[model samples]
Target: MFIDVVPNRGSPPAVLLRESYRDENGRTQKRTLANLSKLPGDVIEMLKALLNGGALIGTAPKDLAIERSLPHGHVAAVLGTIRKISLDRLILSTAKDAASRRFCDLVVAMMVDRLITPRSKLGFVRAVDEETAATSLGNLLRLGKVKDHEPYEALDWLLERQERIENGLARRHLKDGILVLYDVSSSYFEGHCCPLAQFGHSRDHRSDRLQIVYGLLCTRDGLPIAIEVFEGNAADPTTLKSQVDKLKARFGIKRVVLIGDRGMITSARIRDDLKTSSLDWITCLRAPQIQALAQGDGPLQLSLFDERDLAEISSPDFPGERLIMCRNRDLAMERARKREALLKATERELARVQANVRRKGSTLRSAAEIGLAVGEVVNAKKVAKHFALDIRDGHFSWSRKIEQIAAEAKLDGIYVIRTSVPKGELSAQNAVQAYKDLSRVERAFRSLKTVDLEIRPIRHWNANRVRAHVFLCMLAYHVEWHLRQRLAPLLFHDTELDRGRAARISPVASTEPSASARSKKAIKRNANGDPVHSFAGLIDHLGTMTRNIMRMPQAKKHPFTLLSKSTPLQDQAFKLLDLDPMRVQ
Candidate 1:
């Protein structure tokens, strides 16, 4: 017997049960067994299955329950990216021993944890333990019962292989004659035990705390190539030589264009380290140098920017180099506004000091005392050169250095980009753009210090561990950088920035986001009408997908694991990442 459906003209299809047999003459015959049209569709199907000698079983929520569930999708996305980029293999040593494998996993786990939720080593270990299991990262890596000290030990192991790992990254990302961007930033320390931490220009504005300074070298696209740690007391320019040596001696890059800020690629550095070397460089002129260029009879004329925002000029001081001068009205307005504000603030403070000096029986009576008080106020804003002050016993007066301020204002919004690369190899526009790309390094510093990956408040005491800690963070950022590029469609990041650059009138003007980016920002959604997210927010949303352990109470058997069905958004994320959330990376 079999169940079949027959069409009845325009009416609903008729469901029927029938039987077939053969007579003595071998002729075919059939009979209607039942009119199953009145039965529910599922019931009819079940009847057909039973007639075909198939056993039927029932399952209900009460029979099977979810015994355990853990967050898994985010782990899959990030860890999957790590494998996609072969970061694990890049950082791992050549040793194939089981311990080496586990250590590699440990390093990867630490990096994943840092991206997911930055924590202390002990805290990370606790989160990944089988009992706690805050994220599926630990279980996915098969890091069973991670010890508290293992992460530190992994750092030690990683530091030993830092050169090899960096060499691998450089080989992957760097090429001869490419633009290499380098910038330095400092992060404050929590304790005084580490030898690398000391007082320096606190980018974090924590002068009271000891800090460590580090420089990041990146490709023209802003992907990190390598990083080096220095004593917090190290000046920005002082760190350039070691990087030069590393690029030539270690990474074996014969020719490249190094991009640095004016502070890093100073005149002294150029004359000493880079002038005689094969490496070319791109940097901007300092305020003093720009002032000299704009002086009377100099090459950089104010009228040069009247018709256009950028011009290529030359001077005897910078021979055998291309100088690209640029002006932006917006920058000029902002600088004028800030200078006025600082001047007003300084005047107010100085007026208070003058009142104290003139008051009867005032403590600020000596000329030395009055001069000291006046110096503090003028130097507070570093506009002392723009102010004129007079100090005498029991008397004080101040006035704005109008001529000087006017001289400085003439150069506002004006900057000169200097490069050793020739005009044929790199145009004036591209040279200015290369100098502007230094902002990418600045953006990386923002992400490293305060935004996504917090690399500050150093607690490790050993210098090597400190170095390893920083390198690990850089690796984590490396993974994140690639992930962001892949997931940019779903993110608030402007994926059409290159188009914007192409549309820009001049490289000197401020960059504007693409129209699509503007729409995304206004609507909080992408072109597909899905919600857009910051990188962190997207990671958090992906964590909603979980792995569930299912059990049958009556069977008294072992439980089986099943992944929760992904939401549309979660599915879209995995698709963008080209990852399978069900598979462990």
Candidate 2:
């Protein structure tokens, strides 16, 4: 039986209780059981619900209560993505055994925790504990009563499986005749205990702090494949060999082209590590090498870029290799501006030193003293080569190296791409594009170090622990990269990358957003009139969706979990991910 409302002309609708019955001819007909029109609307709805077989637990509607609510939408999005990608299985192949399965759960939990709210091991455990849970992550993963040391143990187990896991990823993403992008980065350490923590070129600008360097090997489009940690003082070039060997021997990939910056794939490393191996390389020429190419009667003349931003040239020094030269007017102008600014600043500092030397009762009485004062000012700006200094006992003089500065200015905004791939295999234009693709790897590093993952302030005292920590962060970024790709439309990230490239006058031109992206930026709304957000903003917005624990006066002892209603935008995000927030776990 059900309640049916019938419209009446010029009067209130008639609400009637009705039942379905079969007549003698076997046709279905509805019969009015009672007139519910005189009853209140609430009572009528209650009767309808009861007729539909929905149980009413309490005597009154107000008897039901919400006991607890936890942030759940963000958990659902991230954890759902992890499972959707089969990242849990990737970490540990089969969870049939209870103990291995639980360990795998802990590993997966640690990874998602980094994405959701990056916390230390102790803090993560406290955040996911049943009583002190910050979100629905604990309940969703069913990770009950986690101890502080369990996370560290999970890291140890992950480190042991790093090889197998990375090999699996490499096989999935890498192939023969592909461009493999590689780069190295460093993060400062909090203590001096770990062997890998040594003071080297501090990319974090924390020269006072010990650090560890790590290299990331990725596909040309920036999907992380493998990562290797090195001692803090390790040189960038020194880290390339292991990655090369890993691709050739460990990952079992052959005939791949390795792309790196000039500092990484140096001439020496190439001759020693890569040249003998049948591997190809795509790297840029260092400043000195570019300067050498532009010297008197050299092939890399400025006129080559008069009508174009990119051109191919040959060099006798680098035999049997193709060199593609590119110039950007904007980059040239910016470099000139910075150079002049630094020169003026250094001149001001040098003037102070000269005055100190010639001032009455000058303390600089010897050449050593005068040279010491002058030396500090010259190299402070790193444009010391642009200045010529004359220092003697109780005297100091300085002048600009005009010829040197002019020569450098001529090469401003100019760079040369060096590649070993044949012209048939990869054209000059494509090679330049491949080298430019290094920025994608750089973007991954930014997400890992500061932007999203915060893979810094290393506190692990064990070498393997430190390695596992960085590896975990890399895996987290791998997940984030996929998330960003799927969520690009809702984010400030440019969705029409191909369109933007098409709009550019030259491949070397600065990037510009497409028309649609510009509109989104200006109006702060997408085509659907929904607000566009940054990745972080979108995550926070999803966090607003919660899971509530509900109970009633009649069934207070057996509370049920209920998902909060999701907004349209949240629904769209789930749609994009092809996930159901209610059934995430």
Candidate 3:
């Protein structure tokens, strides 16, 4: 039996308690049991209580009741996906002892929290205590109450097994003949105590702050395979050999084409270290090398870009290697614009310095001072090569180096890539595509530093702890990569068509009224023509599903917990991730 509300034309809606019965004709029929509106309020309350298995009760004082809610749905969704990926089992297999296994679970919990809500170690502990939904993680792991220091302890343990863990991941996701992308990025440190934190090239642009360098290795599809940490003072070129050794010796990968930026591994290292090991590599040439190829009467000339945007050539500089040159018209325009802006700004500053030197009745009469002022303006722009300036007899003269500017303009938007991999193994276009895939590593670094996992502002002063901190961030990214792939329908992911070509679902808008307008227009939609959400927005939508613990005033001894039902959108998201909303509890 159920209570039903019926509408009327001009009177109060009728409320009837009805029961369904099967007639002898095998047809279902509903019979009116009672007019619920005609019953007294107390009798209606009793009926509701009876219908709810006696769990519902008459109202009591609302002021004395306490209610608490925690973020459950998003965390559960992430945890469920983690379990489906067998991450827990993989971590458990790495453990040699019971304590290590428990620590592994703690690490897994930390990763899940990192995905849902990134927090510091102390903040994580507080979240675990305050959010009852987080305690559900403990239930999933079948562990007792977690101590405050266990997360840090787990980090320490995880550091010891870093090699084994990364090796396991590489074996699972990586294979030979794959184009492996490599890139290095630095995360700044808050303190100077960490041994790994040294003053070097700061990729974060925090030159005043010390930092440690870390290299991320990933497959062609941008799935991160392993991460290596080096001293803060390490140079980019110097870090490549160690990574190549790691890929060959530690990860046991063979016949893989390593791809990196021009600054990462130099031509010298490629000719020596890589050649000695019989390994293949693909990387771009530095500006000087490109200039050398274009300036001289070599096979690669400025006329090459005039006919076509891409061409393959041979160079004496890199014998027996294919040089694939690419020219992007958009890049040319952008570079020209930036160069002109810098030149105009530099001219303005130079004019100010010239006026200061030539001012009448000025005390700045020394030639040394005038020379210093001229040197400052010239060196500040770093465009001294494109300008001719001189100071003489309290007067200054400056002119743009027209010939030099024209020479640079010819090479604009042109870059050369050197690869040892045969054209049959990988064509020039595919080689260019492979090098372009380096953006994936850049994206991974962006996600690590600023987006998903905030792997910066080193909080741990101990070197091992610092390593573990970064390692934890890498592990979180591992999960993030999978999440992005599985949730691609709702995200702006590259889709591969039937013709074996990749296409971006959301193409760059050619024009927009404003930046905000472009952002608003960037939203993607699913096949249903409904607007899809970004990864963050999708997580927030899932977070709306909550777990509630209710305590009735009449039933003081019984407090029951129930997971809130998912809305249609939330259910759809769960379906995309292959997670059952009912199993979230």
Candidate 4:
């Protein structure tokens, strides 16, 4: 709102009022009051001096609120706790500039939501319109503030934060030893120029792109502790032992039971890594590969397996194997039915082939050959074939095909679990249970891919930003994981992921960033009596309240008190972090 005291055509300025006050020397002083609140305080103060208007400003608290109106309420939920870890702030604020703080606040906003990156962060921070944002972003880029490659640096920041949390956790909960679940997977990037991208075994049908190896070490409760990036062409088996070694070296964890999928690590490497290293491991092996071990009656007994998920064992120096009983009667029947169906399919194909041959005036020549080819499609046009039937194509009967399928299916489904733990240290049944516990890693991966930090296409090109980007994503995951560990049971027992993360975030916002936007327009009359208006938009910033904030800290001039002026966003952040919601209310 503007005052009507000033008329058109800036011929002369209208005086608002007059006042007298005692000077610092206790002398009486006369002053002319002017309406300078419409402009920024700094600008108004400067204008008063240029025109010799003796401090035409409201120094009194009651009169200073010239711009007050509605309440711009904000809520800060979780940023309070995150601040205690000061090292993290230093890393993200690497540049120590306008851009760095802006990026950091935006990232903190994500951490508030629990994580984002070039591709991921780009999805958020969308402005009022695409063009406006794009222009602002382009300017930011020119200023070296916001770039496409920022997320990768964020990834590094993520790892660093993980270390902090790990150290913090050990300092707090020593009894609940950390459960480390390990796993390996590959992600392919479709770019020839990508140095780390290469073609290797892909879990997804993405052989066309260069595939990179990734190994994750997650907690039993599904929180990621470490994630390593490898060259695209690297093999999983070769890296497993080294990662295990790295885990020990970095965290100095000796009491960890490394649970892993059978395919993640080789048996030979397991022995090489864990035999001397103070660690216990549980892994499942392919039964058919170890068929001799399965069929033997001396070492391990299958029938002795007390329960379905339970197993019994008795082996040697390293440990023993568990023969889990197949108690799933329904699964057993399904397996049998599946075998029967295969047999039928084979037999039908063989019969169709024989019929086609007979119609074409071809003879089986003999019963032995015909029997061998039965249930197999010898001729391509006779019937669709699923597998090889001992006999050649175009001459089998439906029965032989069915027999072959049934034979194959009969030997297909079974499970064998292996352990390197000693009999005294860990029982066979315990080993089996331990392997089940290993599934914690998979759950952690699920949260990484879905629940919290869904960092996929990793759009950052500059390595540091990319690292920083993924780092925050990881940090968010860590925060939520801890939140759930500490608060899930307390607040929600049956909540699925969608509801959990939504409710777990610390509801918070900082008010300083929006200060410029909250200002009224500054107007000035031109020589022709035309009014010119100017206003600045949002400028992001961040600050934290200190424990010794009770004492007023003096700036270069006099003692300053920020007590009355509240940074509303900071208030919300404190509330979200489960800290005090207000600053000394």
lDDT per residue (tens digit) for residues 1-585 in model 3: 877778977997877899899999999999998887777778777776677676544354652343554556777778887788777677667447889877887888889888777888887766565443353455445556567788999999888888888888888987888789999999999987889989998989999999999999998878887888889999988888888898899988887889999988697788777898778999999998888887668777767666567889998878889999888777788999988988998899888877777789865567777778778877887888898876676777799999899889888788888999998998877788788778889999988998777888887889999988898888888888888888765654533321233332211111113332233346556555556777777877777776666676666787766667777777777788888755752
List the pairs of residues colliding in candidate 3: none
List ranges where model 3 is wrong by over 4 Å: 1-68, 94-96, 130-144, 494-527, 551-560
Expressed as tens digits, the lDDT of each residue in 116-200 for candidate 4 is 1223454443421224332122221222343444533444544555555545443433222344677876655544554566688
Better of 1 and 4 by lDDT: 1
Candidate that beats the other on lDDT, 2 or 3, i.e. the better one:
2
Report, for every candidate in turn, its global Cα lDDT versus the true structure.
0.90, 0.89, 0.78, 0.47
Which portions of model 4 miss their true places by more than 4 Å? 1-118, 121-178, 276-278, 296-302, 305-309, 316-414, 423-430, 450-452, 460-472, 485-585
Superior candidate under TM-score, 3 versus 4: 3
Tens-digit lDDT track for model 2 on 1-585? 889999999999999889999999999999998988999889888888899898876667778888889999888888999898887888887547787777788888878889888888999999888889999989999999998888888898889899999998988899899999999999999987899999999999999999999999999879998999999999999998898889899988779999999999999999999998878999999998998888899999999888999998888999999999999899999999999999999999988888888899988778998887777877788987998888888888889999989989999999999999999999887888788989999999998988888999888999999999999999999888888888877887778877777566677777778878998999988878878998878988899999999988767699898888899989889889889988988
Which residue segments of model 1 deviate by more than 4 Å? 1-61, 554-558
lDDT of 2 at 56: 71
Span of ten consecutive residues with least summed lDDT in model 1? 55-64
RMSD score of candidate 1 (Å): 3.5
The per-residue C-alpha lDDT of model 2 at residue 47 equals 82
